[model samples]
Target: MNSFDKLYYENYHKVYRVALKMSGNAQNAMDIVQEVFLSLFDKLENGGEIIYPGTWLYKVTVNKCCDGLRKQMRFATLDVAAGNEFHEVTIEKQETRQIIEKALFELHPRERVIMVLYSEGFSYKEISEASGVKFQSVGKTISRILEKLEKKLKGLNNDLY
Candidate 1:
């Protein structure tokens, strides 16, 4: 197999899992993985070399996920602002996930992506490259986003009262 093929095979699962966790849905995860590979194919076709295939795939996957979330947010915002009610589930764990997802869903796409990538063990520099943000801004954003998440999670716990 060629280098691109080999890299794809080796890192496909890692990228997919990251996508799945980011998306919280299997279908979207599959779509992001496919999109990443398709982008990889185009890069290889154009003779672009991947010195770090794993990192490249992670970035692509994160980009696909952020794009999907942006589209969803647009639709959701319109629906909510139109006074259309959503039928959200109310189970305990599901409620917790919803609260977390709601806060995550409210963040700027890049911030949300960075938080997830950071949680998955990527350093600030890695997150900056993956999320296409300035490297210098990563630390500030990570600190701010974590503070916001903590506050939101605490608010969620209170809401359960």
Candidate 2:
């Protein structure tokens, strides 16, 4: 396999998972991943060098996901203004995974990306680089996000009781 092919094989799943978490839609995630790789391909085709391909892929993926989410939010708002009634689809029994996902989705897109990257075992510096957060603030932001999630999960659990 070629170098580009090897790079894709190594990073495809990681980028896809991050995209999926950020966008919360498989189709959107796939599209974002495709866009990111295409960007890398273009850069390489032009003889541009990337010292850290993984970090570059992650930054691009996060930016694309954020853009897509912003567009989606705008459409959702327009739909609401057009008298569309949003319906909440409740699972019969909320599994732990479902509950966690629910809370995660409630967070702002940037917060969600930061939390997801952290969970994926990216170091603070990696998360900062990927998510466009400052390195110094990644830890504090994470702590804040964790507290918010904790409260949200607690509230959700209480609702079930």
Candidate 3:
């Protein structure tokens, strides 16, 4: 197998999932993943030095995700807030997930990307590298985003009952 093929096999899912979480849609995630691979191929052909393909893939995926988010903002997101209430707690939990997801969508694209990457177990240093942000900025950004998500989720949970 070619180097690109091996890289694709090992990291495609990671790239796609990061894209999905950042973009907040499965379809957009798939598109971003394809775009990332295409860009990788182009770079390879141009003799670009890729010391760490995984990191490069993530950077490309994030850039595509941000691009998609910008395009999406031209249209309004679906009102996921409008829904029926459930008597069962489990069903209520599902609805809470939906609400939290909606709140996540409302975050700034960069904050959303940081939170999603951090959630996926990427280190602050790795997130810094992938996002092209300074190492010190990673901690502050992540802290702010996580705090925002927590507050939003708490409010959403209160509203659900």
Candidate 4:
């Protein structure tokens, strides 16, 4: 196999899992994965070299997720403007995963992506590279996000986090 095929095979699962976690749905994850690989194919076709393929894929996946969320937000705004009443029903009794899912869904798209990357054991430097946040600021930003998550989650289950 050529080098591009080899890299795609080696990295596809990693990128997909990150996208899945970021998107919270398999359909969106698959779309983001396809988009990322399609972009990669174009880069390789144009004789462009990616120094860190994994990091680049992560960056692209997160950006695509953010784009999707932004589109959803815009649609929601338009729906509200059209006089549609959107009611979100909350579960009274929730499992740990459900609670965490709700908390993650409440976060802004950028924060949600960073939290997923961090939970997957991406280093601060790697997150900075993928997220385009200043390298030095990743820790502080993560700290704040974590505190927010903790505060929200602790109410659901004190021992589970």
Candidate 5:
């Protein structure tokens, strides 16, 4: 396989997982992944060079997910203004994954992205680069997010019990 094909193979799943965590929807994650790769392809086609493809992909994927969330919020706001009643879909009881996902879903988009990137084992520098957060603040921000997640998870567990 060619170099670009090799790069795509190496990073596709990583990018998809990040997108999925950031967007909280499989379909939206798939679309974001496609858009990210398409952007890389376009840049390469036009003679752009990427020194670190993995880092570049992570940044682009995060950006695309954030953009998608912003657009969704706009429409959701409009729907709310129209007096639409939103229904809460019941999830299966006691599923750990669902509970964690629910907690993560409650986080701000940026916080979610930071937590996802950190969980993926990226160093503080990588997280900062991908998330646009300052390097010095990554650890502190992570600590805050962890506290929020822990509290949210405890609350969810209490609800279940």
Candidate 6:
């Protein structure tokens, strides 16, 4: 297989999933995945160096997702607009999802990206590489971010029910 094909085979699934979780929607995730691969192909054709394919893919994915979120914040989010889609789920689970979505939307794009990466089980080093945050800061930053999520969730729960 060609190098681009090989890279696509190895990383496409992961890139799509990371985009999905980060954007909280299928369409946006797919768009980001497409853009990422297209950019990668362009870079490859232009003879740009790619020392670490996985890291580069993830970092680009994160940046694309962050850009989408920032633009989304300027308008509104898919989660907010699509709230009725969750009506078929159990109320408890739906409520939990709503609270989590609220918390995620409240976070700055950087924090949201880091939290998504952490939730996807990426190590601190991987998250730092993807996010450009310091490796030493990932733990402390994530700790604080989780605490913020928890606090927001608790507040949402109390306010809602």
lDDT of 5: 0.80
Give the Å error, residue 159, model 4.
9.5
Which ten-residue region of model 2 has the weakest summed lDDT?
A: 75-84
Q: Which ten residues in a row have the lowest lDDT in candidate 3?
A: 74-83
lDDT by residue (tens digit), candidate 1, 17-136:
878767766777888898899999999999998887877898888878878887787413311111123345445556566667777766777777887888789887888878887999
Candidate 6 residues 38-63, lDDT tens each?
A: 99999999999999999999999999
Locate the minimum summed-lDDT window of 10 residues in model 5.
Answer: 75-84
Model 5 Cα lDDT, one tens digit per residue, 1-161 = 97678888899999999987787667777888899999998888899999999889999998888778777773111111111232333334325556777777777788888999998999999999999999999999999999898888888787554
- Kindly list the per-residue Cα lDDT of model 2 for residues 1-161, writing each as its tens digit: 97799999999999999888777677777999999999999999999999999999998998887888787773111111111232343343435546777788878888988988998999999998888899999999999999999899899887644
lDDT of 2 at 9: 96
Q: Name the candidate that leads on lDDT.
A: 6
Candidate No. with top TM-score: 6
| Residues 1-161, model 3: lDDT tens digits | 98779988899899988987886567767888888998988888898889988888888888888887788774235334334554445766776778778888888887777877888999988999888889988988877787888888777677754
**In terms of lDDT, which candidate is stronger, 1 or 5?**
5
lDDT of each: 0.77, 0.82, 0.80, 0.81, 0.80, 0.86
Clashing pairs for predicted structure model 1, backbone only: none
Which parts of model 2 have CA positions greater than 4 angstroms off?
74-94, 159-161
What does the lDDT come to for candidate 1?
0.77
Ranking by TM-score: 6, 3, 2, 4, 5, 1
Q: Can you give the lDDT of residue 92 in candidate 2?
A: 33
TM-score of 4: 0.81
Model 6 weakest lDDT span, ten residues long: 74-83
TM-score of 3: 0.84
Writing each residue's lDDT as its tens digit, candidate 4 over 68-161 gives 8888873111111111222333233334556677778878888988898998898999999999989999999999998998999998678774
